[model samples]
Target chain A: MSTASTGKSLAFTAGDGYHDDPPLVAGNLSFHEVTDLVALHTEKKTPMAWYGAFSIANIGLMILLLSVAYLFWNGVGVWGLNNPVGWGYAIVNFVFWVGIGHAGTLISAILYLFRQKWRTAINRSAEAMTIFAVICALLFPTIHVGRVWAIYWSLPIPNQMEMWPQFKSPLLWDVFAVSVYFTVSLVFWYVGLVPDLATLRDRTPLTKKLRQKVLGFFALGWNGANRHWRNYEKAYLLLAALATPLVLSVHSVVSFDFAVSIIPGWHTTIFPPYFVAGAIFSGFGMVMTLMVIARKVYHMENIITINHLEKMNIIILLTGTMVGFAYITEFFIAWYSGSPYEQYAFINRATGPYAWAYWTMMSCNLLFPQFFWFKKLRRNVAFMFVVSIFVNIGMWFERFVIVVTSLHRDYLPSAWDYYTPTAIDVLTLIGSFGLFFTLFLIFLRFLPMVALAEVKMVMPQSDPHFYEGHGDGHGAAHDLSAGKPESDRGKS
Target chain B: MLKELTRETKATMGIYEPRRDKVYGLLAEFSDPGALLHAAEGVREAGYKHFDTHSPFPVHGMDRAMGLGNSKVGYITLVGGITGLAVATWLQWWTGGVDYPLDISGKPFFAWEPSIPIMFELTILFAALAAVAGMFALNGLPRPYNPLFYSENFSRVTDDAFFLHVAASDGRFDMEKTEQLLRDLGALYVEVIEDLGTEQGPAGDVRGEAVEKAQA
Candidate 1:
């Protein structure tokens, strides 16, 4: 690779026909240098551990697919859907997957807007995880509706029956919210992929024509021009601005599906914000869980640095605190509302048939993230990974508590019944993990796991003021020119 | 008649020098953008077509200072947004209205309220798509090859250097006079540059031929 300048002069004239030597030393990393780095990460074949993980994911996927087939053939009764507990594992999984998807957009878009440079390495993979997780989430809702074919009816339009979907229903709101969230997230992810796709297109073997064509189509003819870069940046900034509000609104609306209902424990005003915070908290935990393993596997510690992990830890701690506050607020409101039904619901959650789930939720979400408050603990990747897994388990338990605990002890004591997950329910939930991992593995094999262009932009050599070379060959002229007042030097 | 013309015309000539020492000197030398614009206007009115301005960062109104027109990005975004809204609406109607019919939550199949989120998403999606497409269309992306790229020093655009090049194609180009003008305008160094057209076609042709031969 040629690292030295090719001894070419660039002219700048004040008036027509006058030529000037290029003012600054031009330093650029060759295409070969960039490719070498990419090859280092991607050239290696799938590791033994990845194979093991993939096999496990495959098994889980098999179970999930089989269960879905059974459910479709035999109806919702194949799981544990009864009168009092109509929504068991399906709704729980739906919320869980949705929560998992939240952190990707938050890390990529929200952090990007704040100019957090640490996000460059992890954002690509994290966005891929978001898309996959949302795909896993969509499954539950589609199946939970029982008549899977009738799913289109949720969309709003004037039908042949001359009727309109009731706008007041939260489920209808969910149909809108989830679809929008998914579409925007997909666009955001694909747009980010364009530059990296071009990078791949440039480096791939000549024989890989199909790969080139596919990547070329996706790249949409990006050339890294200044004008293209300027607009690319503007569009990205605008998308980030748009996404922040959408992330908040989508989760809040999902929470409304429960909160707007007359169920004593679910019908709280604090549900929306509480759910959003919990979603972010769990989402960050999931990112950490995946990233710790990914960094070790791909040897990307320099790019996905310890500093990035620490930042994520801080967010986890903050959201954990918010979740703890919401839990306390719920209890206080239940007492303050003075309605016997509401009061009973809280007490039942703590001491009822599924008290274990409630306590597990409290400890996992509230207690585990507290460890991150210590700088040492936050920096410990092994410890962080363990805590992240625990947090995920804790969040799943939290949803179980919310859905089952509230519905089990309704206003009418005669109608109250215990909710239990059958074998199919358990298999389906485990299967979702398989689906998530399968998609993630495929992404890992193909995509540029790091944002290479964004990283190059941040390198120190790219700064012209930092380079102390003038057009003249002599060193003293450059220093004497540099002797201009500090404020005037490179002032624009 | 020539003597009378000379008497009537008081020549107020302004000279410009390329300040090679400081890449971003042009930005700081001018007091403000307004002053820069005024200077540009003065030069234009005097029928002196050989001048340029440089800045470390993209200065707002600099295009207008150089007498360039507004870009067409806005128009592209608008058309894209409208198209997106229409497509989203049409897709919803086709799938939910025409293709299948089933009641959800005891409500009519096609609910407009639920469609707002998709509508908003599609609008943004279209706008963003248009923004990037319009940018590429106007600026000509994927060029992969340019005369500027052949000049190794042109990489300074990505770095801290700022520059303005008055092309040789300009009608008033005079090497000695332009150099003197640049020096008068406080340019530290001025040099003439040769255009080198780097050949890159043989590689493309070779690749294409190899593919064809393999297929054969």
Candidate 2:
């Protein structure tokens, strides 16, 4: 895993090449002080800015609830969905939220496997975002099925439900895929939170009994016993291992919902990998948007260092380009397939009715992220935030272009009709953001925003010191435990 | 009167009970991970079986230093995964081929190609659930109270200090000798925890059950 490039260079890492900056965390922080620093946020009253953001998020939540109720009350017709354009804003928003959810798992699970120490500062918040985004994503498909009450029938539950869910259908597969993803992510997030919660509990000696009970309850009696830590670390690694594959499959199955179908733009073989990449792309964008604001508001300049932002931007740049590549590949396939409908479906996307959305997606997802190629811009917080916002908007449009554009003009020209989202559709989409933020805000308010213990682990002071020619001169010469676990042994 | 009644009810419900007994075990605190790790090695080498170390996080070599074996959570996940695959495949075959067969597309009633996504999802579902369930079952969690919580000095285990607790139940545990040993090993603070033998209280026997299960 050492960065050594032979021959022609195709390098991904920015840190591998450039940027000599301060340490990841700012200020001379001792290991003992991490608990106190993070606990300060929870112990103190909510900031005025927090209240402002909270109220805004509350309004959005209200909108989301009303929209869901209205959709159920009146039916799917409340939105602008119809025969030709059946998969409109609901599917679009679902995919968008799901894509946004990807960065959390990528940061927490994938980066943990890769031993990316920089991720420690932002991983907790991103993981929370992932959970919240998934929650929003789950809402779409459930309510999209007009008879929301009959949604249970879609699941592969047993004898009670008259109809068994069709195994072959990608839609039914989504039921299993999404639910499993949610459960696993929730468990992973909670388990990671346990040690931090215990720290909060221990530090809050001056807090009221209610606070004590709450923190203690969630801390799960974790005493940081080495035996417990051993098991906990193993469990964490196992969850991370499981989650990496699970997150990939969850999105791949989502892609299958379209890819398995006979629709022209939807039926491409590249959808699985393409969707996963784009999900990571969009996920990073959302993470960037949050981290930029959070690091500032929480005074985490040192912890979420500029280098961390630069590294993330590099990922955003990479994945955004890959998505651009997928777009080109799709066009090549459409032309190569020699089918008129397939050709027409893609060509229409570029020059057809929804051409504005298509171009917007191209500009936002592809062009905007390419700015990160310059180190100056990537490190520039304001510019990165703007680009991240653009990425979010672009990714949403990417899904919209895929779902609505492909479906609107199908095999029969007679059935072709323009699909426009009703007010409820617009409001609902906005409302999902509300739900995401509300949960995220609550998380930020109560929990340690950064993984304090994990962040501490990456600190230089945590490592064992070797005082040469001193007392116990070489602490265990030929230290067997020092190396990575060889076949899971402590020593010979 | 109302407030007093509420307080009385809360106290009786054990909500107001102390989080831990002050007398848990002998606590030895270390300033750094190295010191703590060295102390763990010393404790392990001295043939103390019932002792444990508490720290802010999992130190890299603590497991090996403590002579602990690798975790068995993987075995549970593997078994659960295989079960998921078998059950999902069988259920799919029964539903699509045998019980309620439908051939709308003229493909086989039971197609493995189409079943892959759902099957993969189920396998992961089972594996993930097992991993979490195994973790909880292994870690002995949801125990909100521990005797360590009672010690003022021990609370810093999640903060700055490194700690090793030698249980009185350990056959080799002699109070003065243990304290002297911990001090020699560079423990900044050493507190011999007295076992009052009170009711297990809110911490429950979850850890004990998990440890037993793991051993068995």
Q: Write the per-residue lDDT of candidate 1 for residues A375-398, one digit (tens) a residue.
A: 989989899999999889988998
Taking the tens digit of each residue's C-alpha lDDT, what string does model 2 give over B1-216?
Answer: 997666444322212222144334577766567777888899989998667778888887888888878888889989889888988899899888888888776978898998988788788878878887877776667666555665666667787777787776556767678878888887665765544333754332212211101100
Give the worst 10-residue stretch by lDDT in candidate 2 chain A. Answer: A1-10
**In candidate 1, what fraction of native interface contacts survive?**
0.11
- List the TM values for chain B, per candidate: 0.62, 0.78
Candidate 2: C-alpha lDDT: 0.80
Enumerate residue pairs that collide in model 2: A25-A302, A26-A302, B23-B194, B25-B193
Candidate 2's C-alpha runs over 4 A off are: A1-22, A159-161, A466-492, B1-24, B197-216
Compute DockQ for each candidate against the true complex.
0.09, 0.33
Which tens-of-lDDT digit does each residue in A1-492 have in candidate 2? 110111111111112212332344445456655666777898798899989999999999999999999889999989998898989899999999998999999999999999888999999999999999999999999999999998888866776645577788889888888888888899899989999998888877553768878988888888888777777788889889989999899889999999999998899899999999999999999999999999889987767877799999999999999999999999999999999989999999999999999999999998999888998898899999999999999999999999999999969989999998999999999999999999999998998999998988775455544221232314322232222221222123
Per-residue lDDT tens digits for candidate 1, residues B35-134, read: 3344445444535443444322233345555554455667777788899889867766666666666666577667677666566666766776776666
Interface RMSD of every candidate? 10.5, 9.5
